[model samples]
Target chain A: MKIRTLALATAAGVALATALPVAASAQDAIYVPLFTYRTGAFAGSGIPIANGMSDYLNMLNERDGGIGGVKLLIEECETGYDTKKGVECYEQVKGKNPVITSPYSTGITLQLIPKAAVDKIPMLSMAYGLSASADGNIFPWIFNPPATYWDGASVFIKHVADKEGGLDKLKGKKIGLIHLDAPFGKEPITLLEKLAKDYGFELKLYPVAAAEMQNQSALWLGVRRDRPDWIYLQGWGAMNPTAVKEAAKVNFPMEKLVGVWWAGGDDDARAGADQAKGYKSLSFHAAGAEFPVIKDIQKFVVEKGKSQVDKAKVGENLYNRGVYNSMLIAEAIRNAQKITGKKAVTGEDVRRGMESLEISEARLKELGMEGFAAPVKISCSDHNGHHKVYVASWDGQKWTKGSDWMEPMKDKVRPLLEEAAKDYADKNAGWPKRTEACDKAS
Target chain B: MDILYKIFIDPFMQMGAAPDLLVQALWEGLVGGVLYALIALGFVLIFKASGVFNFAQGIMMVFAALTLVGLYEWMARHGVPAPAAIALVLTIGVMYVLAVSIEKFVLRPLVNQPDIILFMATFGLTFVLVGLGELIFGGEPKQMITEQLWLPKGSIDMKILGGLVSLQKIDIAAAVIASAMVAGLAVFFQSTRIGRALRAVADDHQAALSVGISLNQIWVIVWFTAGIVALATGIMWGARSDVSFALEIIALKALPVLILGGFTSIPGAIVGGLIIGVGEKLGEFYWGPLLGGGIESWLAYFIALAFLLFRPQGLFGEKIIERI
Candidate 1:
């Protein structure tokens, strides 16, 4: 009889924990689920972003007493950069009424795309995801806020054209692409091929095997042989620096080399700084000690001893960018609450808010993130609100802006986005029909 | 005739046009070869003494480096300065004690088992270490305490032929330390009494036992020595990149080295590592474009496979005489 009583009590406790929260009205609290990889091969990049995401949530709580007086609760589940683990984390956390998920990985985002539609939860991949998800009409659930890989590539090529003084100047030049052999690295291929056809530039492709980033002797040797006028590097982790070192060995001028944002970070620069002088790359967010968001982070998170990782890496580029990622989510939640008059909004409500987000300059200034990113306005037709990107060059020590913001050729990109998204929808049946909020009226 | 000239002769002619580039490629290949040799040496030591391939060697390299960083962090958390943190890291060598205990408890009884069984057991051990490592020390990559360890940063550029050849200070240090360690290991095995016992046991375990040499003592000593080599390699490689699981795959490069060098010969490992390293570098330079580059991935394995056709027993391994 005593044993029966203990078992009954344990069941009652679990029931109470689940039932007690739903009893409260929508204004009680706002819970956001965070999926991150704080351990494994990619932890060098993951830890900083996870820390920044958590700190921004904490800042919202401390500064504003919560969004609309509803406290923010964040649950962090470790994925270790494994796609299977990331899916498991999503399933475990979806029950908590998480309005949106920022997976911070392209591979994880790809796995969760089908689930996002089934669960009616918005998956906000700020920078990396299915590049085709930029077409909101097809991938209504997956939102890439600033830009996709295609946008990044086109913006980079535009910078090249401007540098050569005109698009015609690029007619006969050779351009080489050295990329990691993964979905993440293959993202810009279609757009690059299109650009190659239109601009009449010779395109050479080089593939780097996964986890073999540190030994890129052959890729650089090709650079020596073909001697491409410009080299585009799509790499991650140690591959970035290894490529830089090999290029140095082949006497490939760093100024002519361009890396994607993932390849252009403090870790990559630190590895081959002296040898990689004058290397240029794309930048979506601002870097260095100059940004106000960085200063606030140093004062609030680092000073209070609540740093997510080492205090020394508090203001690093990736860490601050992570903070920006979290801020974007938190603001979207606020916007949703304002429109719905429900402090604790549902996943559907958050999706609507994500569709209508307008991160204006004034909002950035208020959040102490001025100049970190341009105004990002999302709509149903375009999930990637910020198509603008700038080119930045590494000057041995730090990154400096090398060119003004350039936009991708939407006329060339939009058709490809639709085709890719349609193919994805065909493969996974039962995707929700997109709301025609931003479509041109017939 | 024209195709042959373009394929072989013209490239050599171009080498005259760009002798500096050829020399630079060779130098980079040499540095890569040295690091591979260091990893291969660690494998040879463990296999020679115990007759069990320690598949956990790579993770152990990562673990040892992580422990040093963890100790340094722990010291700093308690208000210790940088120099004191260095002293604290040295004390972190107790991980080897725990490692030796694991060998005694987990592996000692499994002795005399089939080689495949022993290999499977080591695979299980690798998983346990990977899990325990993450549990004890969080999974984030930590900067190797280079300043504390007094390793220099940056590289020295030298003009060779017509091109500029550059070598990192850390790579040079790694090459020098690896040579010294291998030399010391050779002397220890050849000149010391315990080393002779180790050799005797490696030759014939039952005979060594009959002659009064304790197999347990030799196994313990060899594992302990391997632990030291792992620690040294861990620090040097971690300083080059950050200490993380990504470095574990670099340890697998030693497998091809083992295949080429013979699993049982120390000298074979050194020579095999150098050959694979230099060959991959040269293949990447001259032949990579034909396949779109990034040939370093499978080049080492192919080289070892081709070499096996001629020297199936490995360069330095004793030929086995099997009775039909």
Candidate 2:
């Protein structure tokens, strides 16, 4: 009787041990902390991105039962587009073990990068962040998935060259850059300067004061006086349409004006669509209704009456692009879960997953977004995996692809990137050391 | 000589070259000026009736706009039709009841205090309104209830001397509404009993008190009317851009407008608004190059400053002879 009792006790202990893993797995939720600005000057962009992020998470739960059966939980903290507030939010939410954070503002991303390494959290900046973060080995915690500003500048210059027949034909031509007087606007300058030197073109710089972009008489006067052959706008908010309108006021050819991706949106065109006809902008992904992903969003999100925006805004350029951004982040999280057998993934796990991600053609096609973006293959050396970009032009109503995907001139950009990164590191003093491989390359 | 050219000759030359652009700039300035006047009108109404410069007028604009949008959104969420949803939004009129209570409880006891103290109290009220508005409405910029309100859209494009001068349909509506409101206010002050009481209070508080007019009652009526004016300005301006805290800054623009148009004169506010509007627009268009553009920001203030140098009492402000 004593032997039988001891054997039953051992079996009960085994049963308890087996149930522990199940309980642990059951409580596992992939927490994604969102730093958003729902109130501020830039809320127009921030609101949509926040809604898209939340809606996609909801879609994951409803459609696929979350990533690998571990439900995704998102906690939002409003940043009001302020960097200091963003840091505070980061500190507050970092304890939750967020897999990754996407602070949509470049200013916020810059502030959070140091904290990212300290907290062991990954920051996934799809497009807006430090350009030098393209060297993922140096910035292991930061991941710029698709492209960088350097890549954007090169693509823009290439488009201009192609328009003028060839790169050699760019010599003796003047390309003016009208940018906001902020870090966000200054991103492409070093790259463009290098490109101008290599391609033998004159580069003119025009800076617009922040919050005062609506008024641009002096800038246009400069435009009229200088007569630059091409205008590249690195502007945001009201600056885009204001520039277009001012250009029209000065009788400058609208076809010659180009803007960065930030300026390419429905609202930007809405104000001065007729005058802004033929205004080209650099885009990393497909713009307009051609993408199947857009159709699916309109069907699944808008048609089902689950959208945060009006049905009319569903297929709009910026709104749909926001949806694509949500899908990308979701895909990265899923990929991370698959690699790490743990049902609950941590920030470090997400970082590894982001570096090793390969969004191939088949995956895109399955997700109904085939040909919308180039196949992104991120690695330790390259954080901005796909440096492919196309030029889209506004034809009064909608955006149309004006050129095929073009690669930036890396030969011109690499040295500049290294210099800027070294300068930044020297100033900061406590920045993480770059790997020997990057050092050797530099 | 170059400085003289930059200050005067160059600006005129540019204006001559870009007459069309100048006209467009003037049009934008005029619209901005009118909005500023609307905000100033709210301030003047309360100041006239209660002798208190309500600093909370800006937040009132934001609060009214937010309430309108929040109510509409809530109605939509409940599957209410657009027309009924709008009617539901009009129920934000209930805020006036709260306003009246605050006057009775908060301000009535502190009556006869110095104007500066009263101003500080209103400043406190500003913060309270901001906090309460954000707490209730979630501190986000919501689309204005323009469609439900049935406001006009697009602009009327006119050609003048080979130049296109486009004015928004809503701007015209704003001008008309503002004119009618001012006219109604003038007639009220000249014709109505309560309006005369308000004017008497503005003229002399103690003397008006001796005439058996209940100052508290006059204050309530004035505050409510000011709230209505704020709501009107909020809707008009919100329809233009959006309903958010950013609209609050629109009220600050009225400070310069108040300075240019005498604080006491209603017609001065209107004419001053138009002058500042037209002047700043033309200044930005023609003279902006000399100052690196964006002159509209400082143009009105500088104009007011220069005008004050010439006419210290403002365009129609009564001169007060100091005994000191």
Candidate 3:
């Protein structure tokens, strides 16, 4: 009986191993791995993004038969928003030879920065990684497109200045920054401090520990006592709603408070409900599913029940943000196909594609995303376009565009970005200089 | 002279100038303390009875809250009548089932295990509950059923010391409810047959068994009682923010309370919670600026460490006189 059982187990193991690879190799597809957190504290913010990223790529497969006739094999590895788990996920998924990696957390992105070049895999951090990575001339493998955190801060200061009639009026006015006490949250401090000195405004920082994200009564008490004229919040996940609620508790004017894009989820605003009305946050992409591309996603992915997203939330802000992210992926793949003249391209090919990537107004309209986001034009020297972003305000229920597209202060931001990039290389001994050539196509 | 003035004199001067802010901070601290005390109350109940450091208490709080919200949403979606009340009752029933299962599956087989073994088991239990809760509730933060439960909304602003101080109505309700629950638990422990049996078990396992008390029954009851406390803490805290796994981190704050208060004393939990909460708030409000403003996270632990150095057994922990 023991001999028979051992032979049966061996046979089953052999059969399983033989069947798995056949299924994996059945289609020649471009592998894309998303380091996502579907469980843990950050899941509230992460779920929609995961759903959005997966759904868009899946929709492409379903509706368009994948980008440029090659299927995109999208896979997700749960990280729970921990940097250690993120690295483990990267190691686990690296063996698959993925065309690109998108580790959504800034912490994860920072960890993968030194590894991406060694592994020859390009990382897309979207709008949330190291601001200095925007200078592709220094850091070639990492990409944080559209706008960097410093760009967001510059625009935020610009918005506050605009609200006060002019930048000259900002002198002596107190500006408080309520940020999560993490690298991502602190990314904007230097830029804001620079702008503060330039504008002659008083800058005060209120850092919230990650553990104490939900508890901010003392922080809000400080806000109440200091009575800063403007408050900028760089909070994420559970911190945003609690901050909004606590700000209301102290009778702080909701209109005077602004948040970064990460803090502007529907759930974040809805937590405060009517009390959060007039609360504003910055956004590069448009909200709502009125766009034609979103309609296609609904038609192909959500309606067919292939999506993990709530059917009602098909066109929400973060979901659309995901669509935009995947759009970048799809566009990069298409550009790579055009550049390398190969239906299937490697990560190096994708890097070159990203360098030369251009999303003109006409191209956006052609892709059924007209007016959805600013026109993006990436080149060899600049990975991030430093694109303009608008402020979206909560009107007791949903978000509405509250301001015109405001450009980031690139004139001031560029010099600082170069200096920081140079400083970053200086800090790390033997940091490899960018060896990749500037593509003339870019 | 400047450093000394900044440390001692500046904070007091600021407090004197903004007396209303001081009052506001005090009220906030008190409310926060009450909630922390409630969480510590769960730990004290289980520790006093089972002598196991139940590291799973925090996840249990998140699980209980998730169960309540998940059940309510399920009921409402299925068109159940009075979904909120029915869901609350069902959640209580679920907690009872959880208590029994934990006692049967986790504790029954390990009846004679070492305290360290049982503590490690709870560490394992924490992960089990986290995975289970995530599987069931899908890990998204849900808004508490505050409107459905008829919890008070909005705040009341009062003029005092020539300025306005705002107090949230829900916080007031939480304070009152916490006090009533603590009082009820006190009465139960001090004046009931089963509660006496529980105390007997807490005193000595063999002695209680010899006196016709069942350790198994006592554990189930104590765990169930702790479950109810967890539910209350979950609701009040969730109403303040939203129901999510993130609330699990706040439960770690109770560890310092347990350290400052005795592991076995109920009143110590409340007093310790108040001290930590109020102390951290005042520290953060007055002195946090000098330290760059995120001191509330570590201030409670620091306060507990100070107490550990001065009173090793805690404010109300029984003195352990071991014979060599």
Candidate 4:
């Protein structure tokens, strides 16, 4: 009798705790649930990024009194970079009727893609996710703005092209792709392979198993033998630092090696110290906490001791990237409020706002993030704004800008994107078609 | 004909073409084997005394390393000289506390339990340690203080078989220290009084108990000893890569070593680890391309599986001379 009573009470308690967030939704607030990861294997990079997202939102509340008088309600559900936990967080927060869900993991973003359409929630995976999700027509509810992996891949090739003096010089150039043997790492392979064939370069592939990330002597040995002229690193977490260290050990030219944005972390390069100097990585936004918006965050959120961020490390690369991500979301919310003339907008309204987003230089100045990121303009058919990506080299101290904005091989990547998106839509069996809403938003 | 040649002859041709690469592969395998052997040694020590599989050994390694680094860094920040001493002491002290708590909270209550239950208990213990370690040390990967610990750094290049092979000085140090630890442990086990008692417990817990051996005491000692081994393994491996929970996954590589080297035999663990390590690297280097270049993920298990099919008892496992 006592056991039965205890069981009943426990179940009731769980139900109430689960339902509390759903019931506590405020009519005066725009709820944006951030499916953030502050722990687990990739927490080295995840913590700063998540803090940036949280701090920027908190900054708006303190500095601007929220977007258009409706206080922003940012809820973070820790995913620990796990897909199952990400989905669970999504289900738990979906009932709260969030304006958006920015799942920072590619795996979580992929899982939430179909659910976003069904749940009518816009899933924002900034710069990482299935590159095919960039086709806004099929994945109307999904948004990966600024650039996609395919776009990044093309941009890398173009940067290489400019460095080598001409595109034709890539002929017979041996380029090695050292990637994590996972879906996220494999995202750029198809585009890279096609480019290799077109450019007449020999593409040697090296896939690092997750467990073998730190123990990559064999792979680097192969790199030595193959002697790829350029190495494109597509790695994350412990893999990034280990790869940089291994490259250093093998006397691989750090300047000739470039990493994707995910691999270009301050901690990653710092792991190798002076040896990692001259290591290059792609960046969609300028790094560091020197922007005016960051000062506002320091003055308000961080200085007030409201945020979990270490105040000293506020202006780091991943943290700045996080600030850039929140800027995108906040601007979209403001856009949504203006479009619908509703301060407390729903997920669908925010989706529209994202579609109509045109982050111009004037708006950036107004936001106090003048050069944080490129001007991101989204449309109905194209989800990723596909902005120019620049190279940032870690010169032992900090990441310094290496190049002017290099345009992606859009002439090459766009056709592939359309075909892949179609393939994805067809493969999924009756993917949702773009409604008249898309035409109106554009 | 193309497929046959690619499978059978091509790898050998490549090996001939780059004998230096083969030597490099062998050296890498040898180093990895040593690390795996160290982790396997922890398993053997606990299993030999208590008959518990102890799935928490991997997490134990992470916790040990984290405690060492965390305290070391904290002390260094506070102007402590030779922080490595403080780090080592704190790590061992934490391990002792862990062993005591584990024995008191987990092992004691479940004493005389079935082996499977003890295995399951270790699984629970894995989660407990992971949560505790993360709570204490946050989940950031920290660089091992090689200079503080006086472990070697940088690399040395030597020409072998018409190619250059560069080895990190740290790895050479790891190999030397691991071999020394193994040799020292062998001497202790063979000669020590407590070692005799531990062996008696391994043979029969009931008999050992009847003969006046304190089961609880032996367990604590074995666990503490394993803790020291874990700390050593953590430092060595962390010197190669950053110390993080991710090392826990690499620790799983010790399982096949356990399989190949029998569960109870100390010598078996060392031999088995080397074999699996060498086998996996060779397979990944030569045959990996045929299987999408990631046979390292499963090749160790596959090698162990095939070996088990025929040997049943591992390479160094003793055949019972006469069944009671």
Candidate 5:
């Protein structure tokens, strides 16, 4: 009976394996493999992001007949944000000739960075990657556009400084950074400490363990004890809601607790309802579905039942961030095709395309994304383009623009970036020198 | 000298300087400890009954909570009243079905298997439940039906120790409910016939089987009991924060609680949880900064290890027959 069962199982496995590729090859399109986390601790944040990417790409196929007359075929591989599964997904998808890989995880991005150099596939870690990856000289194929963590740290400081009257007013002020204990959470620490030291503000850190995202009473107790003037949260997923709830629980001034762009989901602030009214989060893209591009997405993708996203979630902060991320992917593909003069370009071509992206205000207008996203321009020498961010405050109903586009303290940030980039290159030994890409103009 | 002063003298001085904050920390610790105890109670119930280290208990908590919330949401969307939705989900025998399915497929097939194999079987069960739960629930964090469930919202601000201590009413509700459940469990385990059979089977499976105690029936009852504990835990925890699978990681804290409690003792689980939670809170709050902060993750394990070194059988664990 065992032998008979084994024979049947083996036959079935072989049959299924052989049938999958045959089905996949039938779709002649530019395959974009999305390493998405639709389920996990981080799924609350990831679901809308993944939906935006899928819906936008699906919209391109539905509305514009795909970018450059070629259909955009996205094969989503669920990562659940686990590094091991993310790596598995990368390996599984890389062989399928994907134009570019957007690793949503920092740990996964770290693994894929060295591999991206070897595989010659252009990787986009948009808004979140190694702060030093912005130095495109040592890292050629890797890209983290719009902003880096160091930029975010500086931006947070700028806002704090603004709130405190001036930079000199930041002196003797205590700033608490309540963060998740992970690579992504730790990205802002080195920069924040440097800023604190320079600005003469006392910096206190309360790191939440990944396992204890939901259970953070002690962390809040520390937050209460320290009683910093400002609390900056570097948390994601269920952590955000819990942190907000805990803040509300402890009577921490909701307006003073600022979150990074990743922490600014509509659902996050809603966790504390009326109390979370004055809560604020950093945002690069404008929130809400008023943009023409969003309406196009709604009419083309979500409304037609072509996309898995709900009609109500078409223009949420994270959803819009997802839409913006997908917009970047689409623009990169268009740029790659424009540069290579091929309808469907290779990963190498996409690398060059990413290095020389000219996403000006006018181009955004042309793409129906003028007010939706910040105008970013990427060059080989500087991968982090146009580091402008706006603060959005929740008013118990919706997130409104609380601040104008505030550029980071570049003079304070650049020297640190250069040093970190040099240090990274020194550690890696024989890191790739940007000889050709840096010389070219978009 | 300064470092030593900062590490040892500073924390105590700080504690003395602000007695109100200290009281606040202790209250937070007590709340945290209760939640931990609830999770560990589920583990203790299963371990005491079946010796099959159920690794899927965390995911089970998530699944049960997700089901309740998902059903409630679905019902609300369909214009059904919250109580009717609550009644339908609560009365649907979800826990019974889960217990029976687990016993039949997971336990019955692997009966008399090595203890490690049964433990590994639970890991398989974890994966299955995680996939199945995610498939059903769609992975977005859901706010617990606090109002519909009649759970209190907002907090009570008490002025003492020269400052205010804010305690959530829901946390008070949780403490009351958890204590009641623990008390109820003690009675069920002590006097009930099925509970006696469960204890006998827990003593020795073969010996109990020879004495006409059906292992299958006992397994279902125990698992069903664990499921109920999980539900109670889920409601409390989900009320505290949004419900998501990420909350499962908090369940791992129960491991140390179980280790300290000796897995087989109900009261031990509670005591162990309180100790670990309080200890973790105090350590993280006071000594955390000196050690670069975030010591709450390992403090519980270290505490358990220190205790285990003195009492390897755990605080209330029975001595092994072999050791005897």
Candidate 6:
């Protein structure tokens, strides 16, 4: 009789534990699930972004009560940047009626693409994902904004051409690509290969596997032998720092090597100490804590000791990236409330807001982020705005703006994006067609 | 004919053309091999005594490094004088405590168990150390205190053979330190009283226990020694790259070294490390492009696999002679 009573008590405890979260989520709030990673090998890159994303939303809740008088219930599910864990996080949070999800990893973003359409939740990959998802006709539920990997590649080639005087000077030049052998690193190859052919340059390819990221003697040895005139690095996490160090070891001119934006973390360049002075990387938004919005975050959230961020790390590149990501989420939520005439909106409502999202120069000024980033305008057909981006150079201590804004060659990019999107849809046997009306059309 | 020439003649011709690059590759490989041997030494120390594979050796290295860096950072924040030196001493203490605790809590209770069970326990220990290290140090990569430890920096660039070859001063320090540690350990194992006791325990755990040797004590000593070797490997590798959990992946590279050199032989580890390291670098440099590059990741394994087919008992491994 006692054993039975104990078993009944244990069952009741488990039930209560499971039931309490559902009751708490029933409050009148916008449920936004953030699939953020704060652990694992890539956590060095993931932690700052996690802190920036969460602190911004928390700041909004504390300062303004919430958007449109409804509180924002921001929940973070740690993915450790692992695709399997990311998918599991999606499964766990989908039932909470989340307005949107920001899958920080490209691998996780790919996994969530199919589920987002069926589940009616929008996924904001934010400058990193399947670049082909920029085509909204085939991928209505998925969105990549500011620019795609192809745009970054085009801008890099254009910068190289500019330095050499013109496109015609690129003939007979040898260009090398050192990239991680993952989907994220491989994203730029097709665009680069096309550019190589179009411009008559000899392309050298050097791929590094994820497992061999830290040990890169062979790759650098090859680099020393081939002696490419310019090297474009497409790497992430530990691969970035190791590549920087190896370049220094091989006596490669730091000025000649450039990294994709994902490789532009302060820690990555700092790994080479003084030797990384002239290393350059592409950037969509400005870095550092000088902006007004950052100061406000410091006053509202970080100073209150409710944040995990060290005070010194406030304006770092990845942290600012997180802040920009949250800005998109907040603006989309506000837009959703306005369009639906409701305070607490659903994921479908946010989908419409994202489809018709527009952040103009005037709006950026109003939001205290003037000159922080290029104005983004999302349309019904085009999700990524394909805006201009600039290069940021590491000066041993911090990053400084390296170049003026350069536009992506859309003439070469759009056709390829459309073809890849169509291919993706056709490959999936039961891929859904977009029947939902566009926000502008409605 | 083209394939044969590309395979056999082209690589040698390229080497002849750029003798400086060949010398640079050899130096890099030698440095890499020394680090690999240091990690394998940790494995051999524990496996020789306990007969457990001790899969946690890799994470142990990472954990040891994180602890050193974390303690130093904490002390520096607290305004402690000589923080690096003090932290180094404390980290050695912490490693000792860890060894004693592992021997007591993890190994002692499972005494006389099957070898596979003990091996699984080490796997569990790996997850525990990874979590504990992350919890204490946080998950960001940190700079190794190479300067504070008084290790050298910058490289010695020599202009020779019509080209320049740069050898990092830190890599040179690492090679010297590794050799000293190996020699020290060799003397300890051969000459000391505890070393003889350890050999006795390793020879026959039951017999040693019957002859009044304490199994628990010997296990503690062995683990503590392994911890020291792990700390050394971590510092060297961390200097090469930044100290992060990613360093754990490089630990698996030592496995091929173990297979190529006998698992039970100390000198074999060093020889095998150099062979695998130099072989992989040369292979990846000379012939990797024909196969599209990135072969260094698996070339070491292929070399080890070839060794397994010919000499099942590694280069210096004792030949098993069981009279059935």
Q: Calculate DockQ per candidate and list them.
A: 0.43, 0.19, 0.85, 0.63, 0.79, 0.76
- Which pairs of residues clash in candidate 6, taking residues 3 or more apart in a chain or in different chains? none
Across B17-37, the per-residue lDDT of candidate 3 in tens digits comes to 989989988998999998999
Tens-digit lDDT track for model 5 on B1-324?
Answer: 999899879989998888888888887788888889999999988888888778989988998888888888777788876553564367347878999999999998887787899899999999998999988878998888878877888888989888878888998899889889989998899899987988898888889999999999999999988998888888889887888898788899998998898989988999998999888998889888888888888999999989999989889888776653
In the range B88-192, model 4's lDDT, one tens digit per residue, is: 888899999989888888888987888899999999999988888888888778888888888878889898778887787988998899899888887777799
Give the least accurate 10-residue stretch of model 2 chain B, judged by summed lDDT: B83-92
Candidate number of the best lDDT: 3
Give model 5's share of reference contacts.
Answer: 0.88
Q: What is the TM-score of chain B alone in each candidate?
A: 0.93, 0.93, 0.98, 0.96, 0.96, 0.98
Q: Order the candidates by lDDT, highest first — what do you get?
A: 3, 6, 4, 5, 1, 2
Q: Cα deviation of B225 in candidate 3 (Å)?
A: 0.6
lDDT tens digits, residue span A330-439, model 6: 98888888889988888899989888899989889877789899988888889898989888899999988999999998988999999999999999988988898988
Residue B53 deviation, candidate 5, in Å? 1.2
User: Candidate 6 residues B64-181, lDDT tens each?
Assistant: 9999999999999999999999988998898999999999999999988888999999999999999999888889899899999999999999999998888999999999999898
- lDDT scores for all predictions? 0.78, 0.75, 0.91, 0.87, 0.86, 0.90
What ranges in model 3 sit over 4 Å off? A1-27
Model 5: per-residue Cα lDDT over A131-236, one tens digit each: 8888888788889988898888789899999988999999999999988899999999999999998999999988888888888888888888778999999988
Q: What is the TM-score of chain A alone in each candidate?
A: 0.92, 0.88, 0.96, 0.95, 0.94, 0.97
Binned by DockQ into CAPRI classes (incorrect, acceptable, medium, high), candidate 1 is acceptable
How do the residues A140-169 of candidate 4 rate in per-residue lDDT, one tens digit apiece?
999998899989988888888889989999
Tens-place lDDT per residue, model 1, A1-442, is 9999999999999999876764442346777878877777776667778888887787677667677788887778989777889888888878777879988778889989878878889899887789889778888777997888888888878878987888889899899888988788888888899899999998888888875766665466557667899988888766776677667655688888899977776666665647778888887777765677767666766678766666766656667677778877887787787767887888887787787788888988887878877778888778886468888888787777777878877777778888998888788767678653442211
Displacement of the residue A59 alpha carbon in candidate 2, Å: 2.6
Q: After superposition, how far is residue A93 of candidate 6 from its true place, in Å?
A: 1.4
